[model samples]
Target chain A: MSVDLDLIHRYRRSTLTRDELVKVELELQRSPAWRSALNDTVDAHRLGATWAAVEGSLDAPTPSRLERAATRLGAPQHLTRIMGATPNLRRAWMVSAVVLLLFGLAVSNGERETATIALFLSIAPLVPVFGVGLVYGPGADPAHEMATVTPMGGLRLVVLRTLMALLTSLVVVGIAAVLVEERSILIAAWLLPAVALSAATLAVSSFVPIRNAAAGVAAGWLTLVVIWARIADDGVAAFRLPGQLVAAVALAVSVAVIAARRDAFSRAVSTT
Target chain B: MRTEADDRALLARVSRGDRAAFDELYRAHAGWLTARLERRCGDPDLVDLAVQDTFVAVWKSAKKFRSQGDVGAWLWGIAIRRLIDQMRKRRPTPVEANVLFDQVASAEDELFVGGLHGELGESLRSLDPDLARVLVATAVDGLTTREAGQLLGIPQGTVKTRLLRARREARDELARLEGDSR
Candidate 1:
């Protein structure tokens, strides 16, 4: 347990080669008793002056828990930061998404008919659809005008925010559905349609302003569901196999259109 | 725990305002830096203040570290001077002369006091305490005349006079040792 005073002296003078320094550090790590002896040979502490000098610098703000979790899940820090800034994560959108699902669950209570649940599922996606279209849609970010000027490409920034909004909406909706009722079978029915409609909104934004695209897609979905339900004399008609087929087709079309026009989403504030 | 980065990488990150990196560097070096400071200055509180000031200085000026020297030595240089500054500002309780001599007897500072065997150790041990301190502060600790004065709370003129006498005494003792050997 002898301390290497000679080596320590050389170390204090910073005379050790990098290789030698690394070796000593590795050795220090492997042996606690040796580490303690070295500390005995080296350390002491002070309080007030450090408090004065550091002055809260060490208390720098940490990333939000969600952002940190995302990073730990292997997302890069820069991407996580962009995701955290999505406008749709605000309390209003989060609360609305949860509340809308709850409202639908309450309406579907004990009823034997599948009508109300289908109608509710169709409408529940409205919030998320809005979120996806607007989170990255021109006016969502105040700095949208400077979109072209940023080091990050507008499309990449848009995709990250859109993903943030989409993921958050789907998660809250799914949780609310599971927690409130055993209607998961019925609730699962709307899952694909919700994603499809959201993608359609992104795709449509390429041809028109973000606000117009968002409003148009929302209005179009609502009109189709309402008319189809009325014609069938059943609120559940719009969410049946036929409706799911239409939603799937729309989703595929949206993907194709977005892929085709992907190069120009940069000016999506004015044109999709 | 994950394998730690070396001091250079840690310091580079610290200089970039990386708090986590600064934290890692602090954990690695603070213990010994504090121990070394505590040994030189007996006041726990003063030693604590010196250590704090040393790190705060490090955090602010980590970028000044050119790749020229080892991080540990550069840190010690900052720490020792910080302790001296604390000592200058507030006169701490003194280590009893016996306590000071005991450290030498214990061979604790193997590089400095332990090296003082035979003629030098005895000569210093027998010399007047004031003369011995001034001599060690200048010659052993390598402080300048003004720095030794500040550390000992003595005037520079007094430190010079005592250093002169201490040197003559040690020289004479060394000469005697040589004569005896012959």
Candidate 2:
């Protein structure tokens, strides 16, 4: 019935029972001063700048979400750490792995005709290039800028992801190669082309947008294979020693170009 | 108030690997979790690490989250466990007394404690640390007495008693300061 200051304080502290709270609510409605006092008490306990400080700390660098997931799924601790340390590359790795599996399934057991197998292998090496394209540059990864500024930077990140894509593609293709009738030739053809195309894609990416570079390289390779098949009367000629020599030369040149312009990948070119 | 339905929807999206939804959940809970964890440990780095670990766990185990429970409380439980884990790895150095006092004073000022010459802030700073902490947990931090007890490792009744004493002391001090200022 009366305004007890201590009772009001207890009410403000939320230490009151349900009945007591109801009583205090009624009392508070009858007294503006009591309400003001309660507000003042609450204000005095304010955690100034604490929220902003915490929010800033949250923005501090940590492992990427995929890396954390990998760790949770029982990946090797060091491998997870490496994956976590590299941001904006998980999607590329995942896409590369999936592409390899699907491509391997399509070509395994010599189920398809020889022409179909040749065409598939010819295009299969480009799968990682596409994956690499999706990893960097504008319009690809939403976190491209963040990835660019990371301690790993763009060149190392691109290389790491490309290597991952290449390795996963190799393993999948290698397993599928064992199932094919012409295992040695198919492996040789695909392996050299995969490395050459991946390196060329990376090299071109340093100078142009990754998407454009990847598209250009893919189109040129496909056209060359088509032209070679027409002129030589053998579609698999592009997979032979002469073709492998060209690929080896392409790989070397691309590697040299990539090394010379390595700094180009350090800063992202915003296409948007 | 964040509804259980909203939390459930966000968590469901997170379980499906929606990064945006996980980000939304993080923004919603990171502040309060940081505040609560900081109360237990003075080390900012440790608190930050615990917050990070808690959200990472949430992202990984979101599918395990029941749709019917309080998401904030569940997050709190996880944050507390993370704090414990960090403490086990290395004990955090206690915050210096002067630094604590300065923080309380600065926070009071920053909140613009009302009354002539900000008597409320002065009064709050005048209370015993034990009483002030109880008040902060129950009032400012909006924890129930039982929750405050769980956080402070005290009985609920003790939290209630300390909270009462804290308020009484604050009221008397505020009155005295107001009377003096006038």
DockQ for candidate 2: 0.04
Model 2, range A1-272, lDDT digits (tens) per residue?
34467755665443433333334433333333444344344321232243344345546567668677877898876566654554356456566656665665565545545675676567667767776666545665566676678776667777876786677567666665565555444555778888999999989887788778888998999999889988998867798889999999999999999999988887534443
Which 10 residues in a row give candidate 1 chain B its minimum summed lDDT? B97-106
Docking class of 1: incorrect
Query: What DockQ, between 0 and 1, does each candidate earn?
Result: 0.09, 0.04
Which stretches of model 1 miss by more than 4 angstroms?
A1-61, A107-112, A142-148, A179-184, A270-272, B1-182
* Residue-by-residue lDDT tens digits, candidate 1, A1-272: 45566655654444443323333333443444444456545423343344444545445446888889999999999877766654543666677777777787777777654655664677777767767665665556655666545766556666666667777788887776566444546667777778887788778777777667778988998888889978998776777789889889999998899889886677765443
Clashing pairs in 2: none
User: What lDDT is reached at residue A172 by model 1?
Assistant: 83
Q: Candidate 2: which stretches are off by over 4 Å?
A: A1-65, A69-113, A143-154, A164-185, A229-234, A266-272, B1-83, B92-182
- Using TM-score as the measure, which candidate wins? 1
Q: Quantify all predictions' global Cα lDDT against the true fold.
A: 0.66, 0.65
